[model samples]
Target: MSFHEGGPRAAQQKDTRSPGTGAGTVALFTLATIMCLLALAATYYFFVRTTTGQFIDESALVRADTIRGRAGRASTEFLDWLPVTSLVIAAVVVLFVTIVRRRWTAAGIAVAACMLANLATQLLKDWLPVRPYRGVQTLELNSLPSGHTTLAASAAAAVFLMVSPRWRPLAGFLGGTFAVASGVSTLINQWHRPADVIAAFLVVAAVMLPAGWLVLRTGKDWNAWDGDGGHWASSRFWVLLPGIAVVVSAAVAAYALRELILGMEVTDSTSSYFWAGAAMIVGTGHFAMVAAVWLFSWAARRRGPARR
Candidate 1:
């Protein structure tokens, strides 16, 4: 039989296509939507019924109130910087993907997806009537979606789309971590209810999955090298270097800020520090996995095989 007919290569090809199938994509999107809805419902019930707003038990309400008070002292400019940084990072990833993989369609999809996701989040926030909660001395409006969570999730999804298949799992894990962190941060700061954050996550995922699939389908395979016995430089290697630098610098800064500047105690227990560390580790793994994909693609180019 020919290579396309009942061979190992054919089987592998079928397996590869399985993930890109219409049904599979639909299933994934469905699952993401369901999870987000459930999360939103759970958070809404918790905030409305429960008397506490803190993640930790025992004086959780007190701690949440304290954090809210301290938020004023925290520079709003610095807090705004986080979303700006995320946007910059997403732009860099898109640029790298386009230049290295020559996947302009994919890059465009990433940008469009994030924009749509952000728009959806804003619309949802506007449509939902804000429920006011009266604190001991103050009152605040509770919205349906959190901007931070939305931005983080959408940006992370864009990054996940720019990398090779081998690195996608790591990219997804990192994206999920950032999404969760942003959501939790909102809760800890008492800036948003859990439902708001969950809604943001859902809106992002609903937009991202379809965008990614469309990009993959329409994008050109620019990694295909001519068989001219001349070495063609792969841009993947260079693209990975900046990602590595960003992850390392961010991790180091986070560690220092938590332990020294913030004077926070780190223990084996599940704390904010633990979650921060987890985010760093996930980010590091994503960078490393992307780097590996770059190296592997380079090697495959040299070997005259299909580049990942």
Candidate 2:
């Protein structure tokens, strides 16, 4: 059965979807939440407190500092707009999905996710101990779990949660693109290292994945669909694209990192590490978005639909 895109009905108070024990969604929520925390912890350990991680991170920053003049100014200017832009976009998305769709509970969950993720970024960035001096010339301040990347990613995640399942594939693709682009912009502007941005994506996912389950549970009626039997543009192509892009970009990143590992001519700012950093930014961010989609889909399927 197809759920018509209409205004809030009395029926929406009770989700049309089955009210199973929700054991599957609960399990998924647990795993996804754990993964988020794991991602943050692993990133902090490897990138913030370790020597090897500092080398790669600082090297990427050093490379980013190479672009001089107009190009550099433009990138920084663009990145400067990201935080505000992300918030605005997220606000608009939430407003439309809530006001137009009248999905009060879903809207609430999505906004809460966005706010929680960004709040986590601030807490981790400031409350966490500073990146210890590892003999690296980089800044000593804490920058892991970048605030800017969190802003972009969480905003995108909010939109992903607000949209319907049929639209999630496309929403996920576009949202991932915006998020990865924001992370890359931070890299190009030398605002954040690769690990910091990656940590941000992970943090957002950690907060949002559980929130997504909440959205599914509360708004079960409107959340289910008969699957996407729509246009190609709205198909799994969008869903698969991010995973494919991450794989390809990861391959590219590994090749570049190998050049550095082999002690090839990777010392200068002109080395392949720049591309490696960018690829890491893209891969990690998209991977998180894909996982978000998968989590929501899993939650929906697990709950199944109730008889009307």
Root-mean-square deviation (CA) per prediction: 9.8, 5.2
* TM-score to native of every candidate shown: 0.58, 0.87
Q: What clash pairs does model 1 have?
A: 144-196
Screening candidate 2 with a backbone cut-off below 3 angstroms (N, C-alpha, C), the clashing residue pairs are: 15-221, 16-221, 18-306
The number of clashing residue pairs in each candidate reads 1, 3
Show where candidate 2 strays beyond 4 Å.
Answer: 1-21, 67-71, 231-233, 259-269, 302-308
Cα-based lDDT for every prediction: 0.54, 0.77
Q: Summarize candidate 2's per-residue lDDT along 120-222 as a digit string, tens digits.
A: 8898888889889887778898888888888888888899888776667778888889989888888888888999899998888888877877777677665
lDDT of 1 by residue, 1-308 (tens): 77668875555334423233345445654565566456556655554434332222112222344444455335343345769878887888779878977877778888888989988878876765444452322234546567887888789888877765445545555565566656656656656544466556667766775675565446324322223233222334334554664477477536633543464563323244323433433343344334333322332232222345
The residue ranges of model 1 lying beyond 4 angstroms of the native Cα positions read: 1-7, 10-19, 22-25, 38-62, 65-78, 132-140, 219-306
Model 2: lDDT of residue 244: 93
Alpha carbon deviation, residue 147, candidate 2 (Å): 1.1
Cα lDDT of candidate 1 equals 0.54
